[model samples]
Target: MTTSTGKGSIVVVTGASTGIGASTARALSRHGFHVLAGVRRAGDGDTLRANGIEPVILDITEPTQVQALAARIAADPRPLHALVNNAGIQVNGPVETLPMAQWRRVFDVNLFGHVAITQTLLPALLRSEGRVINISSIGGKLAMPTYGAYAGAKFALEAVSDALRREVSPLGVEVVVIQPGGVRTQMAARGVATANHLAAQMTSDQETRYGGLVQAVNSLMDSGTASGVTSELAARVIVKAVMTPRPRTRYTVGRDAALLIRLARVLPDRALDHLSARSLRSHHPRTPTVGVLSRLRVGVSS
Candidate 1:
């Protein structure tokens, strides 16, 4: 770890290779924070350095990396002001048919990794009276069938955030959950690919039951990718959370995130499920395909 005198508050961002994580690191650096960009690969670190950002080699699931990150931060004369636990993976399929390995892998990075990194850095955060931001999804509140594993981990993260928020408020550390409805990212593309792949693998009867639903959701997602707020926009919101005198415990962003998730909450489970099914059937009106990237490219340009 290269030690530099902190001209501004220090921020550590996990999963800083791409998507929200990478964009957030760049945005925060622009905001004048001494951004410690965290990536699992050294090549990513080199890219960050080329861009004039400090890249810390980190793998949130690895205890040693987390510990090493803590040591590096602890050695810094300046206090660490913020930590963004934005590293996550999306694995979607029929819950009954999904491999246990998929579920475990998601949890390892999405839930437990956040806990481990936060715990390791709690003292520094407390000392600086900083904020910990967890990038969760609206799926944490509304359980989507194929999105079960990812949603489950997010739900657990929400609980963890809520509990820790209360526990640390008095101690000067703030915990914030940024729940996004959707955004144009690799996670979305991967989800579409997973659905299309699984649809191909399943029996005709199984496909008949779940195929259209996946197609509809993918259509909805693909429709929104271009219009959804860019990662840089979302990062600005997060930076505000860190800088604000009083930050909200929960922030739901993106189009219709609040209304849709709230509706899912108030509606009865069976009724919501029915509504979801109907929405899937009618709202999208498109077929699922593994070619999400091309669609996203065209959609972005349009």
Candidate 2:
């Protein structure tokens, strides 16, 4: 799962406190690269510092911290091999129910933060012809009910990656996207917690419309995580994307992700809608949630 070809080189991985980011930092270290692992807390950074790995305090949303990371890398002697943009937050809510502030927060963490960090480090990457790896999700390809904000940010990330790839590939910098289905990472539990928190804030009428759906989605998320691939495996796929000489523009981490993304590419909108609804319906609340979306259809009966 590793190669020493990266000997003495440098790689940066964001959100390295736990899960895939943490695993990726270790894996790249094994491959002989000095890893700059980005964590939010000093405690987290402390835990991740060892061997070839050095953790940096990096809240990608904060311009100061991001610039600091860039400066640290710029001062280093090793050539930058790659930058893995793995930091993320998941906030699930229906488009009609999600507050604009929450929506912006999602984009800030999931999309804009990556853009800012990439912009900051492009000089080093251009100097080394290094790659940019973005950790996306199957949700980027197909949005589910109550996943409007999360999926919207991911979809935007996908587009940004595309634009970046086209803009930089000719200049020798590669931009790659990793879309994972259900990886057994801590993100699911965090996402469920956030979903419930947002659900609690909904208006009485909004709760009546979305509460059951929210519970169902949470249930499904739990099950998916239970059955998904391990974070170690997901990290290996990302490492593969980094080490491959001429990597694909996109690499999917799990079988579910590969299959679902392929389907999304070929299936019509109505067909995909039916598929997504069927998959989610099985996890619907024991209560009658079937009429939830129907309520949206039923406005003033003028």
Best by lDDT: 2
The lowest-lDDT stretch of 10 consecutive residues in candidate 2 is 293-302
Per residue, candidate 1 scores C-alpha lDDT tens digits across 1-302 of: 11222345789999998888888888777766778889989987877773436899899999998999999888888778889999988878777666788889989999999999999999888888888999988888887768888899999999999999999988888899998876777778877777665555655556656665666776766766756777877777777776777788988878667887789778888898887777666655355533443354355456
In the predicted model 2, the residue pairs found to clash are: none
- Quantify all predictions' global Cα lDDT against the true fold: 0.79, 0.89
Q: In candidate 2, which residue ranges exceed 4 Å CA deviation?
A: 1-4, 288-302
Q: In model 2, state the lDDT of residue 159.
A: 97
Write one digit per residue (lDDT tens) for candidate 2, span 16-121.
Answer: 9999999999998998889999999999988888899999999999999999988898788989999999999999988888889999999999999999999999
TM-score of 2: 0.93
What lDDT is obtained when candidate 1 is compared to the true structure? 0.79
